[model samples]
Target: MPYGEAMLTIARELVDKIVAHGRADHPDEACGVIAGPVGSDRPERFIPMENAERSPTFYRFDSMEQFRVWREMDDRDEEPVVIYHSHTATEAYPSRTDVSYASEPNAHYVLVSTASEDDVEFRSYRIVEGVITEEPVKIVEAYG
Candidate 1:
């Protein structure tokens, strides 16, 4: 199924942010979100949330900030498009932790890794209570 165009952009930028944050911390998890409408051609918002700690191989997003963002998006008539996180030393696929936590079927789970920053991989998934079903992501560029 078509996951949508905006998710591709979100996936790309999320990789960049993850790389920058990883370089800054040298070896820590960088977590964030890409909140927008599901089927928009171009994304209208990109909100990055800070990870709670500086660690070697873990990322835990701040729940309070997450709630705040959800509210803000809801006010704008937008849904939680995708929940993104980075794998500092692993590949760009979901781990067991990721699978276990991806309970929202309506949202896409994006995972970026630092294996090759320039060669970033973007995969979309409909995660339902620990079961992940991969979804296809498509990008339609703007003319302007």
Candidate 2:
């Protein structure tokens, strides 16, 4: 945690959705983005994305879909606040490949682990230039 407080404050509904997506895509990695107002750093819109690789150990967003989503965000004056993926058999932490592919310096990288159905681990991190810093997540009923 930064400043001894939560670094990621997200809506409970959105949290539920992310966890559900992870659970539904069990045995395979799930990937998605939550777009927010530009420079807001608030993750507001949930956009579930298809994993182009469709592999349990790795994930890659469908390029065409990524293009469309980015265009839509541009039109809406939004940026990716959160870039999230699932870990089917591992913990909610960035893998080496994830660290290599993380390019959004301003976005929070969220990881959801579906390794245990009853205990779905949802963690947030900041991955900048290969440095990974774990942050605390605060799930609220809604953004106030």
Instruction: Supply the global lDDT for candidate 1.
Output: 0.64
Clashes by residue pair, model 2: none
Overall local distance difference test of candidate 2: 0.91
TM-score of every model versus the real structure: 0.73, 0.95
Give a tens-digit lDDT track for model 1, residues 1-144. 435432344344444554565455545766666666655534446677778765656677788988898898888877766676667677768888788777656677776666564565556666776776676665434323
Would you list the clashing residue pairs of candidate 1? none
Q: After best superposition, candidate 1 residue 70: deviation in angstroms?
A: 1.2
Off by over 4 Å in 2: 1-6
Best candidate per lDDT, number? 2
How displaced is residue 41 in candidate 1, in Å?
9.5
Model 1 earns a TM-score of 0.73
